[model samples]
Target chain A: MKNKRIYQVAEFMARVLTNGSKNLVTRETGKVMREALEGRIQSEPQGTVVVLDFSNVGIIDFSCAEEVIAKMMARLIQREYGDKYILLTSLTPNQEENIHAALQTKRLLALSLKGAKKPKYLGVLNPYLMDTLQLILERKSITARELADLTQVEINTASTKLLNLHKARLVLRERMSLAEGGGRQYVYKSLLEI
Target chain B: MKAPLSLHEGSFEYLLSQWGQRLSYPSDIVKINLRDTKFIDPFGMVGLIQFGRYLRLNGRNPFLLLPNSLDVLRYLDRMDFFKYVQNLFYLEPQDFTIEEKYLRRHHSDVLLEITSIENTDDVHIIVEKVRERAENILNIHLHYGPMEIDSFVVALSEICQNIPEHSKDMGFVGIQKYFYGKKLKKNVVKIAVMDLGIGIKESLSPKYASYASHWSDLTAIHLALFKGCSRYDDPGRGQGLTNVRKWVQKWNGKMVIRSGTAYTGLIPTWEFAPYKRSSLTFFPGTLVSLILPEKSL
Candidate 1:
């Protein structure tokens, strides 16, 4: 069960795209998202969950999808929007492909809507990454050696999976220096654990 | 100017002759005779509008010698061309009661007749109509994936959007289904747009002035195919051209861009494609046409 409240982006888009052209321009998408985010920031408290509603939008091009979802998620990540969570709801199959492709290109992640209270992970993930992510979700914080032992994968394989998760912006990694100066180790925390 | 300006889809000489005459002027008074021009298309419509605007800009008041053919006159009236030339030019339709004239009724075998794209609103209409034609047309049928048709629609919208966005002038888009290649002889969807505003050379001058000045039309077209080649610094800009190119390349389709005095054609063998001279002597604006295979590849 999630505690953060959700907001809809379609409310803002309803004000725009009155003609309903299947191919939406990038500027319109960007402008609508900015306005929606502005409203979300003001009315919602910290840790509030925002759901980008694509139910009304039937078609969106790559550039338009990039400007709206990928760029916005990147900006939020770059600025460290720690408490707030972004999810998507009512995505058509085509929209899912477009939004997923854009997010994958930029290596960003956001939760997807499964039901009223259910949020599902949406993005590219191989079986290995899936197991790694599941383990991280079970254990809030874990090191490479611990992940390797838990997954029964090689240390290098585990490290590679962590690095890939880090690249996908799904995991947070920090270098941990040994107390006796023996060596340095890395600690990875699943950002989705929240 | 008494020459017939139909410059029909396949008429090369007429286009050259009309364009040459428009460039050469001896007298300040301009009078054009459109009597014999019974059939009109988007290419001819753009030529007429551009020529009229050109005369007005040069301090020359132009008058139209009304067409002898009632069909031609009605075609002009239906297209809202009179609204453009009403104030500046001398036209015979003084709200005057002449013979009750109506355009000749004819059906084009193509998916769509030459259509005017005056605004963004027109883009939606055209895209929807084209999609409808693909669905309902008897001879040819297209079974597109969820995104395939949408991709084609977006690519087409980008082509039409160029008219209102960059042309800063009116233009026309004509989409049709036709056969291509003598050996293969396969049916394909053909889309053509004619614009009479600043050509590729002028549009790219902001960012590639040095290269544009020296580059021929074909060279400019080749450069235009690249992504991120737009003069504008705005994000999410300039990707459409690349997208269109990739779409064409995927199907090994054929695309030709003609502007200024040169033109370039892209065929299936694009890796070794070279820019070539166009059939026309001189064209004022750009004419971009492409042939996409019926089957998605």
Candidate 2:
């Protein structure tokens, strides 16, 4: 938006794309991204969409991917800006696997930013789903049935995703005693500690 | 048969209390039974190492019977105890027999003797005695590096020091070295230092009980070889036995320790097992043996 060459996007939405980067993703870059997302979200009050463009990036080592992006950037952005995040990359399967494994633990919203077919779905679903998941996480507890009803998805698909989230330890299940029943029912709760 | 080392009832800690005292001489023949004992702990390992060192030093290799515990064998393997004394033998608990000829004919070349604690003050005296006697008897040069010699001296000093500190009995140190004769072509050197006193079990268990299980002799052997692996609280960063084990293993040598009836050996393959009781019973002591190949300089 400002004459910065790093990010360019279409009208009605801001798409930040970084390219041809070689150096390790530093704390400075993470802070800048966080501040930008936070300012945009605060001004719009509808939350901002942030995409990390990694098309020209190579050798995403532990420092860049795991330490910087997954641990610091997503967390700072989510906490300060409530921004929806996506990863735009053509990473190799192994690199994607590593990034996915890292992000799976954080419960960050990540959509691959390649192939025009995905952009439409990304533009619409990314903002909606990120807001929903963020709400569920902040509330600290949500049922699969409740998520299915809200997302308009089938119960089975929502339950499957919730189970995956539980395995990742983003959420925990505890057996709760029901007043009307003799047996206990498992209740899901977020594991964010806060 | 000698009386078993006395300890507070059922406490394995009492077994190690005899680390540095004069043990009674062992008989040429030995017998071991593991049926009555439910478990063997580190103190028990000290007892066995002491006794095995005594018999091997005395020129009589004893036989042993042990429980079928792979965990025990694996534990001993890590310490490298079985690498030292070749004559000390082990069999499954079911295979033990007194009728079979217990002594191997080649074992007569292994000789063991004790030195008065007064002479231990001179490190050169003990080294010279071992080197001279080994060369004169076996005709093999007992050349040792400075680091190796220093480790040996440290181990002897620690054991001797423990004798006066733990065991009330006057500490006597035993020395044994194995030489190759014409019939036994392989050159091997075995040295044992023993004391009649409180063994390792009692001295360590009180302080370092959390790091070790009060159960298998093998665990005691394990604790003996690793750093911070002591049963003594505030154990003075002791590296005596660990250094001994490392030096011996580096040259493909062996070390066996006997505290009471429980014994652990470090050979090419580490084996720790309860050996047969010595024909002559030890009062209570610790025996540390080091064995190296003749080619090992």
Candidate 3:
């Protein structure tokens, strides 16, 4: 895991709005802020977890949320920001609802973290994929073999599910060597753990 | 011409109808007498401002005659009605002043003053201004909880953003809290937003050209409210109005939008208006009125 870079949305909004208003509620404002954040994310090293902290931010209406969060998630999945991952942090319930609604409209998924709380999933996820995501988040890191044993599923099923979650950018995959057979296997690690 | 005694969303048509009749004559100056006006809400104020601007654009000077009632004057002044109308219309009593003896208390029921929504920055300023008063007006007056207040502000933002996003012209918005003594018998907040620009029909024309044969102002509004339609083909484009409708319905409020020659929206039990109407006065832009009543115990 590379170093985590925290972007303060409130500070960025203050700079963007001449009046120093912290609310994010328009497509125009959302587009400008998203572009600035995208530029900053591009400057960060690969594999950096970009945390968008919206704690001090005021209201984020649906349009702005769609313009920023949904669009960013769409691009992130397309590998537009390289190998970096995006995590939302310190979002108010109201903000979460708007962001979730926007993401659901676009069929995207994002993870949000609050202080000392279990990471919450925002946006749409298939029920089956959701189940697999919960397992990965809970175990922090798990091998396909271990997942298949724990869930009584086929090895290929477990591997496919893990790969799907990784492809969705919800988990990080790394190669691990087995001590018994001296063979290599893939391990899926929770983004929160990283 | 005489302005309606009760000038509000319900009577806005009367004002428009009167203006329509006078449109045939070529008069350099149009006089709108308000001496008998007893009540005027935010809708009336914004409607009057837009009317004045509309007349000016049509090569006519709009003149407003002040109401005789001091209470009405005070209410108008408190809502900053004079500040906005100063440049739009020529006041009859050009030197009118409020008597110091009847200077009322600070305005607590006004959620937002008459503000222009010219661009996105104006929307940010409006959201900021309303946030400071949402607790007092939306909470204390309308009994909205934290989540409801947040939703209310967000809905307001989305509605105002529509002006600059699609209107292609400047607009105005005003909000006030009033106690409805009839039917609901509770405090309700009224939000009025309007713009004189391309109406919904014109905005949706590009995407819905296939339906051009059966299209009207009413069809455009219905498509937007029910189908979640927009002019843009982007999947994420048209959720603003739909979400606002959902939020209003969830809170048991009433909302009505009038664009071009038609009007449609979700009407609550207490209100009585046509759910959908077309072939009305040919207004050039869109006008929206939302009423969120106090929550029942």
**Estimated TM-score per prediction?**
0.67, 0.33, 0.96
lDDT tens per residue, model 3, B1-297 = 788999998888888888778878877899999999999999999999999899889889899999999899998988889988888899989999998865656756888878999999899999988888888887777778877888899999999999999999999999999999986899999999999999898999888858667988988988887788999888899998999999899888999999988899999988887787777878888999999999886
Q: Please compute DockQ, using alpha carbons, for every candidate against the native two-chain complex.
A: 0.26, 0.01, 0.84
The B-chain TM-score of model 1 reads: 0.66
- Cα lDDT tens digits for candidate 1, B1-297: 664555433343354556466666667787776666666554455455555666787788877766677666665555555655666578754553335435323443356555677776677678667666555432344445656666676667667777776666667766655454563466666677877778776777777768545666666666777544666774445655666777777767767677777777666652334446644466656777766775733
Model 3 chain B weakest 10-residue run by lDDT: B100-109
Per model, kept true contacts as a fraction are 0.16, 0.00, 0.91
Q: How high is the lDDT of residue A163 in model 1?
A: 81
User: Model 2, B129-183: lDDT tens per residue?
Assistant: 4433444434434454433443344344444444444544443444434344652
Clashing pairs in 3: none
Assess the local accuracy of residue A177 in candidate 2 as a C-alpha lDDT between 0 and 100.
74
- The model with the greater TM-score, 1 or 2, is 1
True-contact fraction for model 1? 0.16
- Cα deviation of B240 in candidate 1 (Å)? 0.9
lDDT of each: 0.63, 0.43, 0.89
Per-chain TM-score of chain A in candidate 3 equals 0.94
| Model 3 fnat value | 0.91
